[model samples]
Target: MHFIEMQATARAVRAKYAQVESERYGRPWTAEEIMLGFLGDVGDLAKLVQGKAGVRPRDDLDNALAHELADCLWAVLTLADTYGVDLEAAFADTMHALTQHLDDVRRSP
Candidate 1:
């Protein structure tokens, strides 16, 4: 799926779960709570990816990583959407530059 669609789907799932959690717990999350929740997920991803990290099987990390990464991406997309950024074009440009860097490295002695 395209990045924009993926981001929207992530937001929908987050909203649905937030509603269920709030109803179960008898309160909606405050902005601070939501930001902290996202921060915790960011830490989860960092734990998996940090240098010298104990590596697990890729399959084992997939589900948690997907959710945490989606949480981070959701925040970024929300910002981009608010500012009218063309995320698709930005991503393509960034990736093209990254590929060029890698190609340059491969060509080095």
Candidate 2:
């Protein structure tokens, strides 16, 4: 999917995360709490990758990677919301720069 669509999907998943957290924790989280929880989840993913590699599907790193990535999106999107960033533009610019960098690397000796 494209970057904007992926951003929306990430936002939707974050909303679901809030619902689950409310159910489990007995209240909706503050921004700080959400950020800290996301960090903890990231650490959990690292531990899972290191310790339970066999438990993941196809041994696909995506299982661990996706969780950590989603957490990152949650933090970034939350920051975007707070600061009123144009995430689509930011994403497009970053991707373009990364593609150029990769092309440069590939074309070099």
What overall lDDT goes with each candidate model?
Answer: 0.72, 0.74
User: Each candidate's TM vs. the true structure?
Assistant: 0.53, 0.51
Looking at model 2, residue 91 earns an lDDT score of 79
Give the Cα error of residue 6 in candidate 2, in Å.
Answer: 1.7
Identify the candidate with maximal lDDT. Answer: 2
Candidate 1 vs. true structure, TM-score:
0.53
Q: In model 2, state the lDDT of residue 95.
A: 100
Model 1 — which ten-residue stretch has the worst lDDT? Answer: 50-59
Clashing pairs in 1: none
RMSD of 2: 5.1
The alpha-carbon lDDT assigned to residue 70 of candidate 2 equals: 68
Q: Write the per-residue lDDT of candidate 2 for residues 1-109, one digit (tens) a residue.
A: 8776866776687688779888999876787876787688777776666645565444556666776766677677765764678887887899999999999999999
Q: Which ten residues in a row have the lowest lDDT in candidate 2?
A: 51-60
